[model samples]
Every structure is written in structure tokens, then in C-alpha cells.
Target: MKAKTIFIVIVTVLLTIFLMDNKDAVDFNFIFVDDVPVSKLAVIGICILIGFVLGFLVGRPRKTYSSYNDEIEDNYPTEQPKSTLSDEDRDYIS
Candidate 1:
């Protein structure tokens, strides 16, 4: 089998073992909160899923200025190299 398939099989086996080992129900309590009973594997798996989702959302690609500028320049270009302001406006100080 390919390396990826082997790795996937290994991970699946390990996860199955972990889930089987954590099947017992556990009581969880937070400060000032009532106790909650849930399977240990369920809590662990839920937390892992939440972490992955949050990481994916937070690590998403952001808008880049170079791509935006390239698109704008491709769509709009000035006819001349000089500024559009009049000579009086350009030479106000100098």
C-alpha cells in the first residue's frame, strides 16, 4: 500500500483504540455549575473537533494588497504619466 494509505490506517486504528479505551461515562463539573455526565470519548472528540474548526476559521487566507492592486491596474490605467492637477495647483508652493 501507499504511504498515505498506511498512515491513514494507522491513525484510524489508533483513534479506534483511543475511543474504546475512553467509553466510560464521566461526570464533569465546572465552578458554580451543575455536574454533567457524558462519555469520555465524546467530550475528547468534541473538543478536538472544535479546536480544528476554530484553527481553520482563524487561519483562513486574508485579502492581499498585491492581488487587489494587480486587478485594479489591469482594469484601470492612466492615459498619461503626469498628474491630472493643473499647473497652478501643482506649483502652488514651488
Candidate 2:
């Protein structure tokens, strides 16, 4: 999954660079402004940074076995059995 994500990011970056280069080919003056237009690399870098931040913010912490055991215990009762079976009923006949 990580490899696939990396591959997608690489492809997207290349596509963005291609589009930006073509778009700017006839409008070279737009690249000189600080806010008129941004470079594709900068845009991609920002996107990656935002993705990392969002992922970190939304990711859940790993649960330990003890916590899971405690949760299960809390949900289930530990009292005695509700029914009693006779010794003759212990064996099943064919």
C-alpha cells in the first residue's frame, strides 16, 4: 500500500509539473509575482505537508492487549452459571 501511494504521488507530481510548464510557457511574467502563481513543486510540497498533518491529527493510537482484555471483561459478566446440568446429560448418544 505504501509503494502504491508513493507511485501515485510521483505520477501526480510529474503531471502537475507538466501542466504548470505548459501553462506558463506563454505567460512567463506570471511566475515572477509572489502571489500571482505558484510553482508546481511548491504546490505539491504543500499538499504533502498538509496530508501529513491531517493524517497525524486523525490517526488513532494503537491499542494494547491489556486494554482489549479489560474492555472484554467489562462487557462480559464473571458470575456463576445460570443453569445446572445432570451427570446423565453430560454424555451424548449417537
> Best-fitting candidate, measured by lDDT?
1
Clashes of 1: 0
Model 1 misplaced stretches (Cα beyond 4 Å): 1-9, 65-94
The Cα RMSD of model 2 versus the native structure comes to 7.0
Cα lDDT tens digits, model 2, 1-94, are 6999999899888866765664331212445554445455556566777987999878968757678779888988878666566666665431
Q: Could you tell me the lDDT of residue 69 within candidate 2?
A: 73
Q: What overall lDDT goes with each candidate model?
A: 0.85, 0.66
- List the candidates' TM-scores in order: 0.53, 0.38
Per-residue lDDT of 1-94 in model 1, one digit per residue for the tens? 9999999799878977998899899899867876788899998888877987999999999877678778888888756577778889879957
Task: Go through the candidates in order and give the clash count of each.
Answer: 0, 0
* Model 2, residue pairs in steric clash: none
Best by TM-score: 1
